[model samples]
Target: MNQLIRTVTLLWSLALTTGDDTVTCLYSQECVLPCKSDYREIIHWQKLERQTTVNVHSFYSGTDQLKYQNEAYRGRTSMFSDQVSKGNMSLILKEVRTQDRGRYKCYTAISSANKEAFVSVKVKAPIKSVDIKMTDDGITCKTSDVYPKPKISWTINGTPKIISPKDPQEDSRGLFSLTSTLPVQPVQDSLTYTCSISSEDSTQTYIASLTEEKTEIDLGQDITIPCPGSQGETGNFTLTFGSSTVLSYNSETPQPDRIQWNGIEVKVTSKGNIILHKLDSERHAGTYTCEKLTTQSRQLIQTSVQIRTASTVGIIIAVTVSIVVAITVAVIAYVIKKRRSKTSENNGQEGSGGTGHNGTPLDDRLQSEQLVEKRSGTWTD
Candidate 1:
């Protein structure tokens, strides 16, 4: 009867000492698998895998025994050495990976007491951002720094389009980048596209369009690129010329000097318009994109600018005027030459018909009389 009572008490004590918990961890971040006690001598933390056990960390004899630590968890697991005497047996795991999601067993032992705890860890990598851009080939949807891989899809004007995306490229940190394109030839000018990136637990979407605002600016004139969703509002704004960042703005503390294109300085208006003085076609004519980052959503707007030089127009007008003047001069010369030719022909005809020296027709009677008089005078002499 005494043996039975002792066995019952031991079983109750063991039951009271053992504990289980669950913790949620973010991928690529630090997490603490919690274990606590008032006494500690040896600690062992291990992951429970199917049909096997993997060593995560272990501490004994007043030092960490990590020589037998699992290769996958090396340099990623540690415990608070100073707090071990106070019975803080929590393990600090850094750079948590998706593979670390499983059951972990923390065994703590001392001279007269022993306790064990189980922590079920769940690691997640949610969708962060989805970026969509307009390209010559088409509009491309892209995202980076996501984990567990992701699926990208596109919708055109509310109709889902079937697309084959490239394989998600994995980075050195085990995150993934995904990109997909859509040909714009068959799409209408007012077409809109929405790109969605889906993970196991979250989805992020961004909407973009082929309809771009067109602005024509004269060369040497100042150009202002406006932020799309920032009318009277305030937040973070990023302006990019093509692929280069031209300006970055924050409402708390604005730094207009963050404009980094072509070693030029610019001004940001209260309404979030970035002004670039003395625009040059070679330097300033292209796509300008403004992105507004807010807590609820991200807004993007694009503008296509064309720079016209006044000198070019002036040259064209000058050439046109010069051609007109040359044509008028040629016509005047031809008319004058025609009149001179007619005058010469009339003079030649009168000369051939025996006209007087002053170009007059001679009277036959007068001429005969003059001849008789002259003849009489000669005979008398």
Candidate 2:
């Protein structure tokens, strides 16, 4: 039909005007605007907008000439000169901004023919902040002001959570504020709920937690405190007590021990929980702080740990030691008594004065008679 041909032509024109290629990137991150084909001799990048075309970058005579670059792109855009050969002419943009969204022109002046590529850049607005909490109703997630509205959803224990999202409100600055709540039902096992917010380019999340202000464990018992993750984004968790970092994950430490992440009482898990085995009163008991950090955000939670020493174990050990000592004393006394009895029996065989070595009379009647006869001469008649 003529109408169909006209619609197709209009669509083709719109595509050519908008661009064939598009690059979506997050705010405050690097973006690579790609342009395939070799333009080694000369290349020019320009931001094309309505009624204005601003110079972004230019390469000529084997050197980058930035004097014509727009001030908005100063020090934020660069092309990979080393990779310019073999039909590669990609420009790297650092810290992309929403205002930078527009069409870009990559023109290369070749001797045979001029080549060009048009690209459309789409900048994603990062979720400024994410706050999640547990309430009587259920888990609630709130977002800070975001532009163009972010994609918000919930996942419970890694499964998609069916939640009715509240209507987002628009602020005066045209930014949007969103809230998503997931009603919790009675569940037997502990459940983990994560609120994920995403833009076209990046995703960030916050997970719910059910931790007390403090945890108490008996000394020599194992304890594992959960790290519920960060509000915005987190790549790692760090556990610190006093000045010492007991354990760290995803930290840039060069030591092999740090690489393996082993501690005396503290160990970091992939789920972000810090596990302590055989809790030590001296080392493992105190205020332990857990920090989750991403490249852009950080979350911290400090929990007091009360280590209780099992005095009953000590008492049992003491009682067992006392019993052993008493038995040893009784055995020594019995051995001494037996030795004395044997010495007395040996002296009885060699009894000279009737009383043996142990002060017992060896021959009672004979000894008494002998003593009286011996004393008769000394006594007066």
**What TM-score would every model get versus the actual structure?**
0.66, 0.44
Model 1 spans with C-alpha error above 4 angstroms? 12-20, 111-113, 125-131, 153-174, 185-193, 203-211, 217-223, 232-235, 242-245, 255-266, 275-283, 293-299, 310-381
Kindly list the per-residue Cα lDDT of model 1 for residues 114-208, writing each as its tens digit: 77889999876666666677788788877777776888677777788887768999887777888889876473443556666677455434343
Candidate 2 weakest ten by summed lDDT:
253-262
Cα shift from native, residue 327, model 1 (Å): 23
lDDT accuracy of residue 309 in candidate 2: 72
Task: Report the number of the highest-TM-score candidate.
Answer: 1
Q: Name the top lDDT candidate.
A: 1
List candidate 2 stretches off by more than 4 Å. Answer: 1-22, 36-42, 50-52, 61-68, 80-89, 110-112, 124-131, 135-138, 142-148, 155-194, 200-381
TM-score of candidate 2 on Cα atoms, chains taken together: 0.44
* Model 1, position 224: C-alpha lDDT score: 77
Clashing pairs for predicted structure model 1, backbone only: none
Cα displacement (Å) at residue 378, model 2: 99
Error of 1 at 282 (Å): 6.5
Worst 10 residues of 1 by lDDT: 203-212
